[model samples]
Target chain A: MIDAARERIIDCDWHYQDSFKEVAAYMPEPWRTKYKHSNWDDAGVKQNLSSFFPTSTGDRQNYGKVVREHSNYPDEPEEPERVREGMDFLDIDVSLQISHLILAMGGVNADDKRVQAFTKGYVEYMLEEVLDPDDGVYGLAPMPYSDVEASLDILDRIEDEEAYVGACFVTAGASPPLGSRKYDPIYERCEDLDLPVVYHTGGSGLDEYVRAGYQEMIETHTLGFLESNMSQIVSVACQGIPEKYPDLDIVFMESGVTYIPGLISRLDEEYLKRPEEAPLLDTRPSEYITDFYFGTQPLEISARNELLELCFDMIGTDRLLYASDYPHWDFDSPSIINDLPMLDDDDRRAILAGNAEGVFGL
Target chain B: MSDGLVEVGPATEFEDGDHAIVEVGRAEVGVVRADGEFYALRNQCPHDGGPVCKGIVQRELLGEFTGTGERVEQYYGEECIISCPWHGWSFELETGTHIGDERIQLPMYDVVVEDGIVYVDTGE
Candidate 1:
């Protein structure tokens, strides 16, 4: 039941660092044995085999340093109590936990079997330890992109559970993208289950930017989220995901507001010039994008309020879901919205919590 | 020229590619002289809260394609664009609209020069 007693402040993208050793206990059979035997902490194994995206060692450190200059957000909390304390500090009533380690699933260089093990283990760990709906904490079941049957089964397992509010679709390093026919079965199930698909972008995932020889986290972090989401949005539009599963709630997280205007404008321009190429699209691509939701973490705020006001007009106030992404390098405080010069009381309430309640069906 | 017009300075104070940020009523207005013409835009950028008028005023870049996605030619165009010092998001000086998206614009004011002194109609 929706809590009517207080003004809602739902943080749609909260996170904590994953405990790999603990997660291994939840893994199935031989993979569990393999993970235990492997030198999990070795820098090489962590970067190459375990992590989905391979970031430069020095640049990765620099990335953290650079982002920390923006805000004084607390470090990642390892325990649930600490997580709640951080949330309390931010005045966030509900936090949907997006796993930091599990986000690497998109670029994991391992085979399907191992990938399935990681996915299963991660969700189980999240459910068993992290999620506490009574306390307003929830998690998205990480869908194993390598196996359709397994992904559907995981959704089935979480269908009756109140804690699993959505299914995670990690976009980094994902081949064939989310719009491909192979992934349709998962989307169809998510629609049937009333689960939103949260497209979470990451930095340490095996992605095109990393492959292109970006040696600095500054370069990779900047382009990685923006470019990957752009490709996925384009792919989803051309493939007609909106038409295929109209009920599916699509949410793109992490990428800020500036990317939206340029991307949608370009997509609309291209669609107008070559309608034949994307016959599945009924109207302009920008229209389809506007229908989707966005998580406003690391919201780009500048001195000029009118620029952001124009962005809000373009995306519409209702479509934006406030996400703190707390305990990260550049987390946004609720005051970011509260302090916005253009947003009146209604706009502030909608972005801070109202839209998230509707989108997540909380 | 009227009670509302805030006197900036002598018209001769501004030269091509030069600008002056002046207080008009409660708002800050930038009176710029670009390409031998005078224009007034809000001191703030619409993209981010950058001091847009405080940045460079120069020619806009133009590009062309030749053959079937093969060769390309790039050069500067006749239009003047003011770039935000923060992120380099440029806007057309003539219209005060973002070059990439015309929907975004700096709040503009009318500039009047009479009897040697320049004035910005802040509409206060």
Candidate 2:
């Protein structure tokens, strides 16, 4: 019944993991010993997926069991079949699949050749295996954050590759804001190449959280997504990336949309009060913000109707893109729109597919 | 409920880049144009109560990923700004929510264009 609409459904946020053996293959000798000794294997990946679904009542009680059990060995093997199954179930037309461990690419030492090797391996695997045969599947290439030059080089090499859509950057890492002079070359390259940058929610690696005495897996997991993206948005805006590049397209993946309207408003106000701080910007912060795109999933329907409407009013319909954080615990698909009582047919259609077409060039 | 939808104005009355503030019951709503499409949102700012309908409606740049696969650039769209003529807090006209306060959001209304006339749902 939704075939026509389904064909238009482009999932802006999806994930892919590496196989245990594949990861083990690239680990340096010292890390390989640690990896093998930890008994890091594919079973852990299956366990993660199973825990995400919690099919049975007993499974629900064991919600955090998988994360706890694999705390020391959190890596997972990529299961391409499981991903395909998810796409089939959701009836998605296209999925923007991000790297699994790629989130850690940010923290990897730039001087380290091993980081580059691993990134190459991951990108190659994704292009050759996951995306090549499936027209509906697209890869968001991972860059080596340890070395910005190396990252740009990798992007250049794969820029023309089939099924390669854009690049993914972890929200929290040692890398400066997208606008910082340190990242100018990268932003310029993306601006020149026209690839959109993706800032995903996870991949903080928990170093700070662990230091803060936070041990609960759920707390770490939930807070990681929220803090990472929120800070990234603020950093990008404050650093004046929008003004510096003026053309850099960025997407905040899996970060809910409810907070965007408020964040942009605040940024604009602060910009006005302290123009010297963001001297490069010629317009209000929100004006530059509309230039960027956001993928909405796990919509916070709990927000008041006026609030949701207000967000749409501020953000504009074209700037908002639709997404299904497929296979995740809080996966939200097309049906979620049906639950929105205030949205009319046009609003619902725009959120469902129309906006996505404009964003992804569908 | 009002038996008939409130007639805001003639569709042609609102220029491509303009907006109209219509009174429905006790509430004022805003209708604006962008990319040849019309959108409506509540007239009140979500941050501090302010008249958003009178806010400036302008074209602002939005970022886009070009086909080149490396460069990202900006594109413009119609945006409504309700600046608190007092505090100068600007809200995006399409969404009634404040710029940075995710906690507060504005109400949005529905508008329709027919035979060159603009009509708004008064919740009637």
Candidate 3:
């Protein structure tokens, strides 16, 4: 079923809904017992805390009303066969299916041991039940950054697993930011293994939403991702993580590309005035920002071609990877990129798969 | 019934909230039935070229600010709308005007039911 007419497509951020109860079965003894017995009655917490906390405004899609009312997409926790069907529909050759629960790992307000245990459980479950790279269904190892040792161990375990092509850093509510020297060991390991690191962000900025009095999904959804990723860009670039690691393949997923121009300009503006504060950086912040790859899922199709091209030009077209956050309310079809007037065949091929092929070494 | 009219099907083919996409000359029109009337619109979405006719047909959701400046929302049952499946852009079924913006409208075709046959004046 491969479309010979086009280049191979690799979706970097295909999200898969993993059941908490199922992941719990993979958990080691005491945590498994605790997860099943815990009584968190608030519906929002109960519904999502098993994976990650829900957004302050609650579920973003109104609980799949769009799918029920308008779309023909399958429901969550789809079998691998169904996922293959989805990839086939989009003509995607490879999909790095991220677990929804593990995506919330960074945002979870829990003990490091509990987080590590659940992270291990989730990864193990994925390794056993979900991953099948031969079918182009690959996965990422969710790094529990709160404990560097544990994160390193998870990386070691997945280093040899063919299904695991990258390591994920859930960017919501990540303390000390990703640029902190505390995470150097994990970065070192990833660099050593030549595994790309994906910084996938979530909209569940619970504390930020509540503190900012964001009453609606629109408000929080709009700023939460931008705010989180922007902070990380500043943290990573200023703290010199890019310079220190040198070879760590870094990717910022979920957020669209438009934010890059503004954030980098702002970083450069501030960096020029306060070079003393961030002594580790050897070049302009924009140069490092351009080095990082970005996932184009929620690829802003609404923007006029010239504007989107401008953003791509700033980052160089090769750094952009096509990601379809499918089954979500705002999923982009491959046609969105395929039909864009601005992209010549070369631009389309690069964004669709070429960049990802190089980045993940597929 | 008329020479210029494009034959869609029998009038009975579409029930309330039902739709059928038909090729009319060079145009693809989605003929929908709502409240015992037929409305025809170009199947393609102006927003993103999505198949707008294949989307959900429902009452439009409306919002208003109350006297205290608090926002309240309700579904206005008087108007039936079709939302684009790709991005959920809603357009009025009868007029084909975007519910949120009058400037963006789906191309509409005139439908006439004659002697039990539904015909669309696709203006070929």
| Clashing residue pairs found in predicted model 1 | A52-A107, A52-A108, A52-A206, A53-A204, A53-A205, A53-A206, A302-B49, A303-B49, A304-B49, A307-B46
Q: Which model is ahead, 1 or 2, in terms of TM-score?
A: 1
User: Any runs in candidate 3 off by more than 4 Å, and if so which?
Assistant: A1-5, A36-59, A62-65, A68-76, A206-212, B1-13, B66-77
Error of 1 at B10 (Å): 56
CA shift of A300, model 3, Å: 2.2
Estimated TM-score for each candidate: 0.69, 0.63, 0.89
RMSD of 3: 3.6
**DockQ values per model:** 0.03, 0.01, 0.35
lDDT of each: 0.77, 0.64, 0.78
Worst 10 residues of 2 chain A by lDDT: A64-73
Question: Per-residue lDDT tens digits of candidate 1, residues A104-170?
Answer: 6665675558778878887888889889999999888888876899898889889999999999887
Model 1, residue A216: what's the lDDT? Answer: 47
For residues A1-362, write the lDDT of model 3, one tens digit per residue.
22324668888888766655667778777888876676432222224544464545645544332442322233334455667777787678898988666655555676547778878887898889878888988998888888999898898888789989999988877888989999989998999999999998875555365376667666777787767777887898899988888999999988898889998999899989998888888879899989999988677877877888899889988898988887566777666677777777787888888899899888
lDDT of 2 by residue, A1-362 (tens): 23334345677777665654556554456544555565545633443432455332222112321221111223445556666676666666678787666655555554547566667666766766677425678878776654688788878878777577777777756456445577667777877777877777764454344246553445665566666787778777777787777666777787677878778877878888997887777878788776677777757765788887787777776666677765444556665664567667676667666766665555
Off by over 4 Å in 2: A1-7, A23-76, A106-111, A207-211, A215-222, B1-124
DockQ of 2: 0.01
Query: In model 1, which regions exceed 4 Å deviation?
Result: A1-6, A41-77, A205-211, B1-124
Top candidate when judged by TM-score against the true structure: 3
User: After TM-score superposition, what is the CA distance of residue A247 in candidate 2 from its true location, in Å?
Assistant: 2.9
Native contact fraction (fnat) of model 3? 0.15
